[model samples]
Target: MWISRLSRFLDSVKQTLFILGTGLVIFLALRNSIVWHMQEFWGASGDFWQRRWEELYLLFNQDDFLLSVFGTYIFTTAVFWLCNLFFILLDLTGKPEFLLKYKIQADKNTPLRPADFMKAAKVALYNQTVVGLPMSVMIFCVMKWRGCSCSPADMPTFPWSVVEVTIFTLVEEIGFYYTHRMFHHPRIYRFIHKKHHEWTAPIGLVAIYAHPVEHALSNLLPVALGPILLGSHLATAWMFWALALFSTTVAHCGYHLPLLPSPEAHDYHHLKFNQNFGVLGVLDRLHGTDAQFRASLAYQRHFLLMSSMPVTQQVPEPPKKKSVSE
Candidate 1:
């Protein structure tokens, strides 16, 4: 009975660990080769970066680095919106035959209405322009005042890049967990976080549909704080931000697509409203906030699904369906 109860849990852990290990190994192994090919093809060498970095330093004086700062934010954010659009379009299609099987809350939630999609998009746009842009400018100013490097030549090596990104993820996880939980406080929820939670079964566009204050503090700060504390190179910062955006979008995306991490955990958070606050589930597990989630069917359903089969978990084979002969 115990084994039966834990079978799905163990399988989830195994699948997650395997994916993490394989991704780490592949990224580490291919990193140097990828960098070499990039450098060779672009005719970029140590000298080239040195000059470029120097030029960037000089350019900073002329425009106060506004161009680089805004350009990076805009470019990375565009990727996030494009990802949102992809899933939004899919959801708006009313569970097309092909994707219907992948929908996690298919029975409970209705197809995304065009009106709701437009509302989410409008709020997201408002947050991006009104809250996001100013925050980016402020952060850039602070980084400059702190003497943080934004130069091309200051980029971390591939191995160190991996380490830094891992640290950023940890930092973001802690910040996001606490801030997100704080917003769920009963007193504060109605005023600030309520807008975001309106979509219990969230779609990708709902990822950024939040109060401007919540958007800046809860969403952006957790992510930007890591790079700021580390004073990372601009390129590394952008890379991490892009990954964060994509991952958040995927988390809010209702369907479990192939070759991507499962959206079950965060989707469960939206459905249940008090569980799985952190991005990686680190703090959730640590704080026991995931107790309800783990005990629910959603936890059992979590997996890196690779096929078109309905997402499910392994059970203990039902005691071999003992027959009369037994």
Candidate 2:
């Protein structure tokens, strides 16, 4: 029995890894292809930045800009990973039973209609375009105001220090954590966040997908907060933006593999509507919100099993549709 169970566990691991690896490859291919075309189009522009190996090395040697960029990268990535780590642990180990209990039912009989897919796509595009462009511009303006040079060659020179990055990381974390939770509050959620929740089981495309107001509020806070609190340079800010987008996409992809947390961690919250609230950790544990989440999962599994029984034992279907003329 133990051997059989071990074999099943290994098979599950393999399947999960396969899904995650494929998703990542697809994401990278799409992202890089778009980035390449964008570069080709804008490369000649004086304001556009081209990422090249030589230039990257040169930029690193420039103490001030390099220090700032590296600091921001470490800070943001650390906070993002740490938060995901905490939640994954909670979901996977702290409550392994939660996984089996709260499995989301795939409504096979009522497959996701075309309309649902379109709505999700539309919301995703609208949210990204409306919020991303304006926020990018605002961040650019702020960087200019702060006298931070954007050009790779013109970057400032400063000593590399862990202390600086640590401080910046804390500021960004606090800003993101509070802003994220605030949007989920009932009052704000109705107006700003409800649209994103339309896809309870998100599939990566809907990662940044949100209502315009919510999108603006969510994206702008980190951009604005970094400059005001940490006085980060433009390069650092841009890196932060890229990392944030990548991480958000991963969180919504609904697959887990080595080196990353499971989408189950975040997807479960959306499925049940209340729990795992923190972007950086399991805040639900401290606040007792996870209780309902546990119960909801159990409720979902019971219904799912009942719904999956043979058609003979299932409820009768509605009468067949009559002809339009009839």
Candidate 3:
């Protein structure tokens, strides 16, 4: 018991470090570029700088923020959206029957009908383009104002760049866990988070299928938090967004692929409704929510058995044969 508790504690600590590390990388990356401009225009040192505030306000107003917001969000979202859509289609097509083993809720997944797939795809994509896009724009605006770069030159190259992206990803996941939990509040869930839940058996693109407010707050905000806090490079932030989007997409893909974060965790969240709220399940475990979630899963198994729904239950192994001598 103590060993398990310690493991969870370490995971939380590692995640905290990732957040701080990401912020540090951003601050360092932006210091010469964005921050330098900030200091120069605002005056590095001045009388409690009330004038600097006025100057900064004018700079904010004059800069082409709308272009920055829309352009960055659209481009980054498109790149990963395509990547996600590709994998989703791959899973649906299942060129090799062996790949089916990766499916999570295997029995519950109805035979893929062209009409049904299209309908689900349509709704998911619609939500992303409409609701998700605006949220991304807003999040980009916040990160830009706070000092994250929009210039490619600002990004550190190659292996080193991975560090920045890696840390920010961890930070984003942690931020998402808490923000998502709040979205499930009784008052908020029906009005906002419920839209995403409409598809109990979610598809890849459902990652972004959500109410506008929920997308902005629960989805984009957590993602945006890392770059804003870190003051990350444009490329670093871009890569982070790409990876985070892919992760969410796969988590909704309804697959239980080995050596990958499968859909099981979030699938349970969607189906069961009240448990497994965290992206990585670290926060859920630390908070003891995972125990409740596991219990619910057990209940589901029991219910399926009691209802004699063999089709929905996993196939049991055949009884062992005994030797005649025994």
TM-score of each: 0.80, 0.52, 0.67
Q: What is the per-residue lDDT of model 3 for residues 1-326, given as tens digits with 9 covering 90 to 100?
A: 98888887787677566644766678788777966675565453432343443443354463435435654556666865685765556556764665565555666443455665676667656666787666666676677678766543343544455666666666766788787888888987898888889878777767877777776777777777777787876555666778787788877877655455546668888888878888766677676566666665432432212222241245443468999998
The 10 consecutive residues of candidate 3 with the worst lDDT sum are: 302-311
lDDT per residue (tens digit) for residues 112-133 in model 2: 3556556655765565455555
- Over 157-267, each residue of candidate 1 has an lDDT whose tens digit, in order, gives 655766788788878987999999999999999999999989888888888999998999999899888888887776667778889989999999888877788899999
Cα-based RMSD of candidate 3: 11.6
Q: For model 2, what is the error of residue 79's alpha carbon versus the real structure, in angstroms, after optimal superposition?
A: 20
Per-residue lDDT of 22 in model 3: 64
Report the number of the highest-lDDT candidate. 1
Ranking by lDDT: 1, 3, 2
By TM-score: ranked, best first: 1, 3, 2
What lDDT is reached at residue 322 by model 3? 97
Which residue pairs does candidate 2 place in steric collision? 64-156, 64-157, 64-158, 83-280
Against the true structure, candidate 2 reaches a TM-score of: 0.52
